[model samples]
Target: MTTGSTYTLQEINALSHDDFVQALSPLFEGPPWIVAETWSSRPFRSLDYLHASLCAVMYAAPLEQQVALIRSHPDLVGRAALAGTLSPSSTHEQSAAGLDRLSDEEIAAFSRYNQAYRERFGFPFVICARENKKESILAGFEQRLHNSPGQEIMLALGEVAKICLLRLRDLIRS
Candidate 1:
């Protein structure tokens, strides 16, 4: 479906499990498992319930799986972004945050932060780019660097939830 296409809650509730997974697959970065798991909670009462169910499945997953989800995301303004290899949703999200318009110095700063965050936390730093501009994003990179690994995991997942919520808001009609 087109990024601007939205599904009515009734229509979403009626989709087959496989179709449901396919429809919502882009809501998460990597895995369809989260949407797959949420299918069991179908006939959702509202968009809020659907979003909560999806996030519940993800948050309940084992730590390794959670980390793997975070790992699947590309670094902000990193190689995939520069190479024009990001998923369309990601490309739009990054571009919205002005990451696509960075200067050489800004690119270097992002590279340094991306490397440092990966080295420290074993995963790329994640944030809801739609909620930030270049300055706030850079500030976030600096501030979040001080977070402990476990804390960063929770924080990153929270950011993922925010991203998903915005995506859901864009795609779901109550």
Candidate 2:
């Protein structure tokens, strides 16, 4: 697989569909479908352009595809196995890492909220979680659970896009 930041424009352009997706695996934490759609078209002039195009594709993708992207994300409650897997350049951005510092009561409450959210939405709770704390995330979960399925799905997708954008920015900047 292509590793590090040494890809040439021609190399990127020459990648097959599967190769491209593999190279971008670090970017999409959730489902393969999301990475497939996002990386199908390559040959970006710069990272900014790439990020913009990704956002456009995400917004234009089908609902199921969007959900796949959101579902690809790692559970918010743990450290990402790979470096740079999550955005915001801090361990605190990881849901699990941040929650690890919380009291048992807080963790229990978050678990309950997560279960309730999944029961209602048919998927795990989704959040950008860059600078948010455990309390804020749980509050968000509570508030978002009240939204209709259609609305929540859209909101989840938007959060996924934001997470992708942040990660992409960091990828290019590094």
* Candidate number with greatest lDDT: 1
Q: On residues 63-118, what C-alpha lDDT tens digit does candidate 2 reach at each position? A: 78777766655555533423435533324356333754677677577768877887
Clashing pairs in 1: none
Give, for candidate 1, the lowest lDDT window spanning 10 residues: 1-10
* lDDT of every model, 2 decimals: 0.91, 0.65
Distance (Å) between predicted and true CA of 6, model 2?
7.4
Q: What TM-score number comes out for model 2?
A: 0.73
| RMSD of model 2 against the true structure | 4.8
Residue 93's lDDT within candidate 2 is 50
Highest TM-score model number: 1
